[model samples]
Each structure stands twice: as C-alpha cells, then as structure tokens.
Target: MEVQYRSQFPVCSFRLTFAVCVCVRACARAQVCAGAECWSVHSNHTSQPSVCGHDDDAFKYCAYTITYMLLFPIAILSNTGALVVFFWKCWHRSSAFSVVMMNLALSDACFSLTLPLRLAYYFNRGIWYFPDWLCRACVYGFYLNLYTSIFFLTVLSMLRWVAVMQPLRPQVEPVRMARVCVGVWLFVGVASVPFLLNGVTQR
Candidate 1:
C-alpha cells in the first residue's frame, strides 16, 4: 500500500495542478473566493470601494497583491528570456520538444503581461479604472494561458517519455508539434470564452 501510494503521488500532484488551473481560469481573480461577493468601483463613480467576503477576506486581497507583485516581474522576465532562448535553440533543429516549450514560455509571458492591470486593480483598493472589456479580457487571458501551459507541459512530458523509451527514434517534426500547440491554443481559447461572462459581483 505504501509503495502504491508513492507510485501514485505524481498522478495526484498532476490532478491537483490541473484542478487549480481550471479553478483559476474559471474565476481569474485570486482575491475572489468561491461564492464570495465582490465589486469594483468605476473610475467616474464617486463611491468607495466595495469589499466582499468575510472579514478575513481582506487578507486574501493582501496576499494576492503581494503574490502578483512578486510573480509579475519574475514570470514576465524569465518567460521572456526563455522565449528568446528557446526560439534560437529550436531554430535550425528538429526539436519538437523545444517547440512545445517555446509555446509554453510564450503563454506564460502573455499572461504575465496582464499582471500590471491586475496589480493596478488591487493597488487602487479594488477600484477599477480600466474599461469593462479590458477587465474581461484580462480574466479571459489568465485562464486561457493557465490551461494552455498545463496542456503544453503534459505534452512535453509525454514526449520526454517517448524519447526515453526509444532513444533511437528520430526527432519529431517541429511542424507537427507546432500544429499540436496551435490546436491547444484554439481549444483553450474557445473554452475560455465563458469566463468573459462572469466574475465576482458587487453587493
């Protein structure tokens, strides 16, 4: 039983990670909790920010602000550098795996670009100065990237296994992997459309 549990650990961890991606893509707000009430102030409105959720929920916002602040720079910068390195490395090579990684890094970089808007929303104390469409886009992009990166990583892992199993197998065509990555982007993009329809609401 112990050995079985140990062997299953990786599967459990993957499931947990996938679950988190689904949840985040559905809501896209780290500060917002399930069934929690939330609202943002319009720039033109002369009203105070509306706080939602329990008293301790304020801590959630604080935590998100700090986390996003720290993550923004690191994710954005690292992913940017990775895209460059991966592109050049994969260039002139039939490394399908590296192509997948380029897409993964690209997805991360795209999402990281949206962090400033999110940070600004939090910085204003929940007052939203951006247009409603922009808000929806940010949330949409967050989830889209979330799922895309997961699928890419999964594909990369499977490819790694194939590489290990048949070390003599010729490298997969980069074009083929690019097609797979495109399919992932399209599938996740279509699935993410529903996220634009909902968000944390105000009282």
Candidate 2:
C-alpha cells in the first residue's frame, strides 16, 4: 500500500508541473497577441511625423513655415538697412545714446543672420539637418544677440532718463561709452558659453 501511494504522488506532482507550464505559455501568447494588436492600431491611427514623442501636425508645420518665411527676409533687410544707416550716420558720434543705438542695431543684425537657419529648420518640419557645430553656433548667436539687445536697450533707457532729468550733465565721453559696449558684449559672450557647450554635447 505504501509503494502504491508513493507512485501516485509522483504522478500528481508531474501533472501539476505540466499544468503550470501550459498556463504560462498560454498567458504569454495572449500577451503577445494583445501587444501586436495594440501596435497595429497605433501605427494605423498615427500618420504624422513625430519629433521627441510629439506629433508634428501639418497645421503646426505650415504655421511655423509661413511665419519664418515672412520674418526671415523682413528681418534681414530691415536690420541690414538699420545697421548700414547707423554705421553711415552715427558711428562717428561719441554720445552714450548713439553708442547704445549702434550696439542695438548690431545685435539685431546678428540675430537676423540666424533667421535663415531657423527658417530652414521650420521648412524641414523641425528637423535640423545642419552640422551640429553650425547649429550650436547659430543658436548661440541668436541667444547672445537677444540678451545683448535687452541689455543695451535697458542701458539706453537709463541714459535717456538721466539726460532728461539732469538736462545739463556733460555729454558722455566716447571712450567711456565704448568701454560700456565692450563690457556688455563680453558679458553676453561669457554667459552664452555654457548654453553653447550644452547644445553641442546633447544628442
């Protein structure tokens, strides 16, 4: 009777193990089928190109393309004209106001130069095909110009305020105004280094 009981125990254990293996395989197949179905549905539903997990819809692409196209030429021509006029008429002036205006025009012109790259990026639907270094340089120039413009504009406003309030203060020396412009440019350049480096390093 004991021998018979031991034999039956082995059979029961074997049956239990077989049942678990079968159940696991069945569950795995079901999961595979479900995953395949979900993937098929997702692929079918999404037709637009994606960038960084976000869909680049046609409307968004068109909007940016139109905006960049319109702004690119306008910015380049106007800023170029302004810079030309500033150098032609105001470059020899030594007043703080003139210095600020010159720097502002310079900054705007530099920013405008980067707009063609931006236009190309948007035209390509947000994909950057340019060399990584060029892209970084363009981006750095854009940001540097932006901050420099802001800084110089603020300084210009303050200078105007002082001129209006004092009404009789001696004119700012050309050398001093030149130093201020240099300092502002240096500050902007130093501040932009990290951003430029990070952009270059990123994937």
Candidate 3:
C-alpha cells in the first residue's frame, strides 16, 4: 500500500506542473490578443483632423485672407509712390524732416514688400514652402521695419514739437540726421541678429 501511494504522488506532482504551464500560456495569449485589439481600436479612433487644426480656422478663412489680399496691392502701391516722390521731387531738400520722412517711407516699403510673401503663406493656408533663409529674412525685415518705423515716427514727432514750440531755432543739420539714421539702422540690425540665429536653429 505504501509503494502504491508513493507511485501516485509522482503522477499528481507532474499533473499539477503541467496545468500551471498551460494556464500561464493561456494567460499570455489572452493578454496578447487583448493588446492587439486595443491597439487597433486606438489607431482607428485617434488621429489629427488636419495639420493646421481648428485654432487657425477663423484666421485662415476670414481675417488673414481678406486683410492680406486687400492690403497687399494698396500698401505696395502707396509706399512705392511715396518713395518715388521722395527720391524724385524732394531728394534735394536736405532737411532732417525730409530725411526722416524718406526713411519712414523706405521702412514702410520694405514692410510692404514682405507682405506679398505673407500673403502667399496665407493663400497656401499658412504653409511655408520657401527657403528657410528667405523666410527668416522676411520676418527679420518685418520686425526691423516695425521697430524702426516706430522709432523714426517718434523722432519725427519730437522734431515737429521742437519746430512748433521753438519756431526761431535753427533746423537740424542733414549730416546729423544722416548720422542718426545710420545709428537707427545699426541698432535695428543688431537687434535682429538674435532673431536670425533663432530662425536658423528652429524649424
């Protein structure tokens, strides 16, 4: 009876080990199947609707298109006409006021030239296919013009105030005004250096 019991113990141990291995394999297969199903469902459901997405929808369709298209030609023509008049008719005046006005016109014209590229970007739904350097230059020129325009406008106002208040004072020398303009250009150029560097590194 003891020999028969000992023989039966070995069979029981083998059966228990086999059942555990089968259960582990079954659980692993079940987990794999579940993971595959979950991945498939997630892939089907999760996707971006569009590249640009909904944030820019209003601007892309309404504001950007309308404003850029409308203003492009108007800005270009007006600024160009101003510049032509300045260079052709008023170039010989040599007044500080005229010099500042010319710089203002030139800045406006440069800003206007960048508008067409911006218009094209808007037309393409904010996609930039141009060379990176050109895009950087456009952006740099835009900002430079913006700040310089503000600066020059402020100077012009100051000059106007002086002219009105101190009516008897002598006018600002052309050489001094030229030096001021050069300083402004240098300052704006230096300020824009960081922007150019950032553009080169970023996308």
Candidate 4:
C-alpha cells in the first residue's frame, strides 16, 4: 500500500504541473491574438487620434488631416464674423451697458484667437508645431479672457443696480462711461499680468 501511494503522489504532481503549463501557454497565446486583433482594428480605422495611444504612421496622418482640414476653418470663420459684428456695431456705442458688452465681445475675440494654435497642435498629431513662445502666449491670452469677462460682467451688474435704484440721480456722461470702460479693461489686463509672466510654453 505504501509503495502504491508514493507512486500515485508523483503522478498527481506531474499532472498538476502539465495542466499549469498548458494554461499559461494558452493565456499567452490569447494575449498575443488579442493584441494582433487590436492592431488590425487600428489599421482599418482611418480617423482616430493616434497620438493618444497607438503609434502607426497611417493613423497619425488621418488624425491630422481630419482635424486641420475640417474643424479649424469653421472655428476661424465663426469667430471672425463675431469680431466684425462687434467692432462695427457694439464698440461704437456709448452707454455703460454697451461698454461692458463690448468688453465681453472683445474678450471672446481674444479667446477665439488662441484656437488656431490648438488646431495646429491637433493638426500636428498632439505635437507643438509652433514656437515655444507662441504656445505660452496662446495660453496666457486664453486665461486673460477669463478674467476680463468676469470683471466686465461685474461692472455691468453694478451699473445695472445704480441705474435701477438711482435713476433720478444725474446720469453718467458719455466721456465718463468711456473712461470707466477703458479702466475696466486696463484693470483686467493688469490682473492677468501674472499669467503672462508665468511663461506660457509646453503647458
């Protein structure tokens, strides 16, 4: 009985080892097959952003082509139309309300100008195609618009309150309104100075 038991133990161990080895090889082969399938799917798909993960040359080209040829032009045209209308109609007006609205429009214009660089970045497959300084300048310009919009909106609200509660009080002159608008813009610009100084490159 002892001899039979000892012989059975070795056989059991051998079977266990064989099963483990087979499972490991099957898992490895499954992984390889899955990787190949992914590569094939990527190769067939034309417009995915290859920069985020895959490194195929064909995928990169398709991604750039779609981004530059399709999206960038639309953004530029829309923003340009906005700027033209704002300058022609809004900027020439004199009321405190119009003044704040103009500042908001101008902030939007400045913000829109920064999109071309982003378009270029996507066109270049997540790469920085422009100079390092331009990248920094673009980001700084974008953030400046944020602060400008906020400041101008605050001014607008204050002006609204004064108009409602104190309409009987003497109205602000056009010249003074112009000065307040200019001062608001300048103050917002000054507040954004830190972003400009931070060096807008890479990030």
User: lDDT (CA) for every model shown?
Assistant: 0.72, 0.65, 0.66, 0.57
Candidate 2: misplaced stretches above 4 Å?
1-57, 91-93, 200-203
Q: What's the TM-score of every candidate structure?
A: 0.69, 0.67, 0.68, 0.54
lDDT of 1 by residue, 20-106 (tens): 445544454555465654556678876555666444445445555766776777776677778778789787564787788788888
Worst 10 residues of 1 by lDDT: 4-13
Off by over 4 Å in 1: 1-54, 199-203
Question: Best lDDT goes to which candidate?
Answer: 1
Angstrom error of the Cα, residue 7, model 2: value is 99
Order of quality (lDDT) = 1, 3, 2, 4
Q: Is candidate 1 or candidate 2 better by TM-score?
A: 1
Cα lDDT over the full model 2: 0.65
- In model 4, how many backbone clashes occur? 1
The TM-score between candidate 1 and the true structure equals 0.69
Per-residue C-alpha lDDT of model 3 across residues 1-203, encoded as one tens digit per residue? 12111100000111232354455455545554342323323456874443321333543444555566766677777777777765663556667776777777888778778877887777777678788888888889878887888788788887877777777778888779878988998999898887776554443
Segments of candidate 3 deviating more than 4 angstroms:
1-56, 200-203
lDDT of 3: 0.66
lDDT of 4 by residue, 1-203 (tens): 12111100000111232354455455545554353333333556764432224334544444444543553455456546655654565447645555556556667666666766765776566678677767768877876776766776677677766767776666566567668778877777777677666653453
Highest TM-score: give the candidate number: 1
lDDT of 1 at 62: 58
With a 3 Å backbone cut-off (N, CA, C), the pairs that clash in candidate 2 are none
